[model samples]
Target: MRFLGNFLTNSSRRHAAAILSAAAFAGASSIGFAAPALAHDAVLSSQPEQNETIKQLPHEIILNFSGEPQQGFNTISVSRDGNVLFRGEPRAKGQELILDVPDNVRSEPGEYTVGYQITSSDGHATRGGYQFTVDNPDSSAAAEGSDDAKADTTATSTEGEQGESNSSVPSWLLPVGGIVVIAGALVLAIKRYRDIKKD
Candidate 1:
């Protein structure tokens, strides 16, 4: 009888350990499944579209995103060659970040890039750029009323960097969930061990 009790106790310990291992595995799997959602927002489409050539720059530069970007700390900059032609704050509307191009800003026929930094819906800062060509041979290369164009490129850059540093959400919630699962498993195993002792 003494030997049998010892064997049963050992078997019960193995069973409890198995349950703990299974719970840990399940928690890890759940974190893996959630990894994709941890990614920041991305641009789904834009006004000019990537690499598209157009005769004229639109009055509004629109960027459609996969998620609704939050309001504030949003910027749009249009550049050609090394020159920043336009840089300004953009308004967020649902999933769209819209920049109303100032009438004074003009572009020459060449490749242009639209760079953006916005507060993503998940509260993380997201930055990206896309290029489009302007084939408007009739338009002048120099931006008209150059003196009127906002020369706040440095400020915009600084603000964007600050926003990125400030708006971070913890990338991993796995440790907390894993701990909970392990704790629960331990509690369950303890209860089972007590029940076996009583039996």
Candidate 2:
């Protein structure tokens, strides 16, 4: 009877220790789960300095974020007088997004809107816009006329270089090269086998 009582006490103590340990582990895990949720807020900072006026228009617009975005889901739109001006693909650079603007954006002094939507790593989405204006319309017009010719020339030269580089490689050469190497190896193996058989 004494042995039975001692056994029961020891078993109860062991069960109690296990329950306490499980509770402690669960409490620790619960604390860890709250961390990611707290860090998931979407934040955005954009260039052209919200409401800034510049003499020269920027070739590229940039937006820096607090978190990495979901690929293929982020979008940026620039407009002047409610007409969409730039709607191109955005490239991600670390936590920043760089968008290439159209080369022919009207440099005339007027209010423009830059709108953006970004989805954060934790799936939270954020959206916002800011306005900026060009102060000198005539200056922009003259700059545009001068820049138009230069931009076209630069684009043409770049395209020509790319085309030349691509034309240097014949599409059929890759397969032909592979086949030649395989045939040479097969011929060498056949000769070696014949030599071995003769020996």
Candidate 3:
């Protein structure tokens, strides 16, 4: 009975050890699966966050990441219906990247698609984008405004160049005009002198 008891006791201990070993392995595997999540750079937060709505447009978009992303290869852009409203050159500060939205956007009310691409701390490239909305869905005004802005820009540039050219014209014209006038007067005087002398 004593020998049998000892054998049973040893067997129970061996079984418990086996169970503990399996549990340890399972815990390690779960941790291994979670490691990849941390290894990759992910969006921690953002301005105009995913699915957020706003009343007005902003001059820039911002992103915060779980890890520090590499610089010189990051980009941020905002668009509507594939027409880009703003594309900013990403400026990285630690784990955050700030991008400027061009003023031409004029905060038109519509759904905007914000896209981003960056090199992660792990040397991997990450690409993603999200959509946001402005309460005013009347993009027609914004569209018209943008067109008018473009026309204004074109007109301004044309005016600027024309102004420069126009301002410079009289400078050269006065000299040439004076020379022609003086030459004509001299010719007329000589003709009169010869005619009078002949008479």
Candidate that scores best on TM-score: 1
TM-score for all models, in order of appearance: 0.59, 0.50, 0.51
| Cα displacement (Å) at residue 79, model 2 | 0.8
Candidate 2, pairs of clashing residues? none
Where's the lowest-lDDT run of ten residues in candidate 1?
Answer: 141-150
What global local distance difference test value does model 2 have?
Answer: 0.82
- Per-residue lDDT tens digits of candidate 3, residues 43-113? 88999888999988776788999999987788888898679876767888999999877766677667889
Please give the TM-score that candidate 1 achieves against the real structure.
0.59
For candidate 2, the per-residue lDDT at 139 reads: 88
* Model 3 vs. true fold: TM: 0.51
Compared with the true structure, what per-residue lDDT tens digits does model 2 show for residues 23-118?
A: 999999998987776665343677787888876568888887788777777888998879888876589887887898787776666788888887
Error of 1 at 62 (Å): 0.1
Residue 108, model 2: Cα distance from true site in angstroms: 1.8
Candidate 3: lDDT over CA atoms?
Answer: 0.87
Each model's total of backbone clashes: 0, 0, 0
